[model samples]
Target: MSGLADQGMLDLGPESLEYRMIGPRPDQAPTLVMLHEGLGCVGMWGDFPDRLAAATGCGVFVYSRKGYGKSSKATLPRPLHYMHDEARESLPRLLDAIGFQRGILVGHSDGASIAAIYAGSHQDHRVRGLVLIAPHFICEDVTAESIAQAHDAYDNGDLRARLQKYHADVDNAFRGWADVWLGNDFRQWDISEELAYIRVPILIVQGEDDQYGTVRQIEIAQEECYCPVDVALLPGVKHNPAREAPEVTLRHVSDFVTRILQGHEAAASAA
Candidate 1:
């Protein structure tokens, strides 16, 4: 709930991205970066990152991409290349400015997709790995239906009011995200081709009952990626696995990263 420091800013020339950094453990490996969902902000993560940092003893960076949370609002209609722009341009700049050499990305929903794109694309191999929760690849009928329902809930239901507690500029956040998703040009939004370039180890987590996306999304990602990828489908869970199944999510992430870290040590010993 702290301001300014709890929510920091990253300069991106004309645009400044909003972010929060916690868990300054100096000795930890592969700093954990928490990437929020499409309509999420630091507040919206709801202490999950903090709890995760404590559990893993790693540095944590939680940030809202431009036009969301307390970050700079988009002045023009977001181009169809929004996610691509974030992954190819803005995310690298943010990490460079923050001086993160290597880190494990943990992202949910849209954030997860963006993280995957970045890890898959980075030439320097700075992204050690990824933990994706309910990520999207290609736009699907199920995604469209869920977004339509979200638009309705935002306009008529109490979703707007509920979302306000998490975002400072709630209207801007909701409208910016909703307008783009429902826009005609966005119907073809897909990242499958972009994701094919990813070669780092990945952990994909999804809910059996997720209303927002189909299992095919994760399945496609696992099948297409040219790297080690693991999938977990939580039973009876909804879209937000971090909230609905925190311990389960944490354990999966912790164990996967632990195994990777151990593998790194074993390789070092062999060498």
Candidate 2:
């Protein structure tokens, strides 16, 4: 049942935020929730989720936000509170709607920020662990510069077409992210405060060659998290660590999730 799609709706104010689910074993084992990047969707994730799920024997849950993939397109402009709202309001609603009480979150870029915010804010929830691939904790000059380059590549280069292979509506997904980040208001966006509240173990991964973020971003996350934070820098890897170094990423993810769960079980037994 690879790539099988399902629909889920979460109530966010007066509007119903729709999401699309992909991959098999959505409810099986140590369920791994795959959150896409700012310009990503279920299709954009390619076969990574399926392969990871198979390798780890974990149920994989993937969902496209209101504006991306087969889910409902966003009509309103993205506000400064968008990411915060997603982490605080939309995520919990979606999880509760789907009955996901506990699971590991695999997040990238914007999705990674959302994961950090959620893990920090929801003190009572059961987030077994987190795997942050190319996550960011704060706004930096380097991030803005890379995003500017990405804008040029998207408009002047063939990057948009290359991305079309992964997105059904590539332009919508691409511009939605680009415009939001490059906007005047978005320059103030930062999530470091949210990271301080997270008490769960986290695996922060980044590629040394990643143009969008620097080592400082991962280091900030390590400092903020209340629990153990394992940092891995993949050599010769870029912003898309999972795509560029699947084997290495998979091994780390599998080992981290298993060890965390085992440690929890041991503590429970002792108690």
Top-TM-score structure, candidate number:
1
Tell me how candidate 2 scores on lDDT: 0.77
In candidate 2, stretches whose alpha carbon ends up further than 4 angstroms from where it belongs are 1-28, 269-271
Q: Which clashing pairs does model 1 show? A: 120-198
lDDT by residue (tens digit), candidate 2, 1-271: 2323464554555445445454444444456888888888777777788777777666677887767765666655677667778888878776766657556899999999899888888984568888999997776778888888888999999998888776656777777777777787777887888888888889988999888889999878766767888988999999998888988888888888778877877887999
Worst 10-residue lDDT window for candidate 2 reads 1-10
Predicted structure with the largest lDDT when compared to the true one: 1
Task: Give one digit per residue, the lDDT tens place, for model 1 in 148-201.
Answer: 899999989999989887776787887777778778877788778766788678
The whole-model lDDT of each prediction reads 0.79, 0.77
lDDT at 87 for candidate 2? 87
